[model samples]
Target: MESSSPPADTNRASTAEGLRFAFGTLTVLPVRVARWDRAAARTGMVCAPLVGLVVGLVAAAVGAVLLWCGASPLLAAVAAVAVPAVLTRGLHLDGLADVADGLGSGRPAEEALRVMKQSDIGPFGVITLVFTLLGQVAAVAALYGQGWAWGAVGAVASAVVARGALTLASREGVPAARPEGLGAAVAETVPFGAALGVAGCCVAVPAAGSAAVAGSAGQVVGAAAGAVLGLCAAEVLLRRCVRRFGGVTGDVFGAVAEVAACGTLVVLAVL
Candidate 1:
């Protein structure tokens, strides 16, 4: 009789391939993805939070080192904010700027998307970028002033939460804005259960850590509150995107992630 065991090696190879795709697409990380099919793309988006986890940790590490070296909180915060921008090649920031320009134009779906696709930044883009960056810097600085640990915590939490928003956007029934491009490639590829499971883990891990040091109940509640608010911010943006553009695009995905990060940081800083 022959053994009926599953192909463990094949499964492992597939997972590794998926991870490479995720990091390659989501970050400036030097990873080569060998596959580009629907399954691979779905796996990549599902695994996006893993990239966020690494990015957040690196960002926090930079801020912590600077603070230890006697840098001011503001400077450290700026460095922290700049690290993600550098790591992702400012892709998310660019998306945020483009989406801002498009929405601010008050044009119809096609016109708005066309405006967003333009290479040049508009006045609305510039204004949105300035305020958003300033808000992130200020929030991180506030956390840093409280303590380096707090800053680090907030950094990690926000990054993970932001990517969680992307996971949300990737779920089934979330239509793509265009029939081509990144949106079309990965749109509605993620199963609702997968998105929910990843999102819950992303939201819960940080909250659990907070509970460990600062007592269970209050810390958990605070983290939950922040996560809820962050998700809400992303949801509102998603709704508006659907209304204005007919569905989420690659740029809209990035915009949701950035907005969720900002919302998470603001909530953490306040609470």
Candidate 2:
């Protein structure tokens, strides 16, 4: 029998090593982490979207299968949208809800963080989840109307772009809300260049791929623009999160990913 990979608690670092940590920590899939040190976490966050690449591909496959079965666009869209949430155990959506609850509470920073920590969802959280999920469903459904091929492109791109936002959230100057936890471990570990490179690579993938599939430079440009806009939207929310909660946290990363993804889908449909 083959030996197992190292346990998740070990400390190590490298892009290759980071891939294990990223998949293990971010997804329900059982990719073993090489180690869990700060180096691993930083690289893990940097390589975060690599996990999304697989996620997007899987989501595209799910949508494609539903369409192949003669399902309506809306039905196919719902399944496609649900795939990532199911895979990630709804981690990003939960963060968006927590952030909504925290900011909407209109309390002080410490109080807001406390509100987010609670196990129960608040009214703000509930409302945000409803609208955000609705927006994703609506947008993907619209894209599917164009064709399942188009829908597949949008689904995969949106997944990657959403995960890309987490890298931006970790840039230098972003503070951690507390002395310990995920925030403290990953915050500032990804420099601006690393974040920019990751974002550029992610946006480029769909743009280049779309051009090949749809055979239009305009479509490629539009997809690229939508991805950038999605990242910008996430940045706006990140600013609010910082001002509201005193800094970034694991929850903040999750919130940014979800919102960015939704925004990307909306733009993809319209553009």
Among these predictions, the greatest TM-score belongs to: 2
Please, what are the lDDT tens digits per residue for candidate 1 over residues 1-271?
Answer: 1112111122223677778988888898899889876777778888888888888889999999999999999999999989888989998999999999999999888889999999999999899889989989999999899878878887888888888888888788778778777766777777899999988877885686567546358766787678778878998998898788888777898899889889888887788
TM-score of 2: 0.93
lDDT of each: 0.83, 0.85
lDDT of 1: 0.83
Reference-based TM-score, model 1: 0.92
lDDT value, candidate 2, whole model: 0.85
Per-residue lDDT over 57-91 for candidate 2, one digit per residue giving the tens place of the 0 to 100 score: 89989998999999999998999999999999998
User: What's the lDDT for residue 30 in model 2?
Assistant: 80
* Candidate 2 residue runs with Cα over 4 Å from true position: 1-12
> Which candidate number has the best lDDT?
2
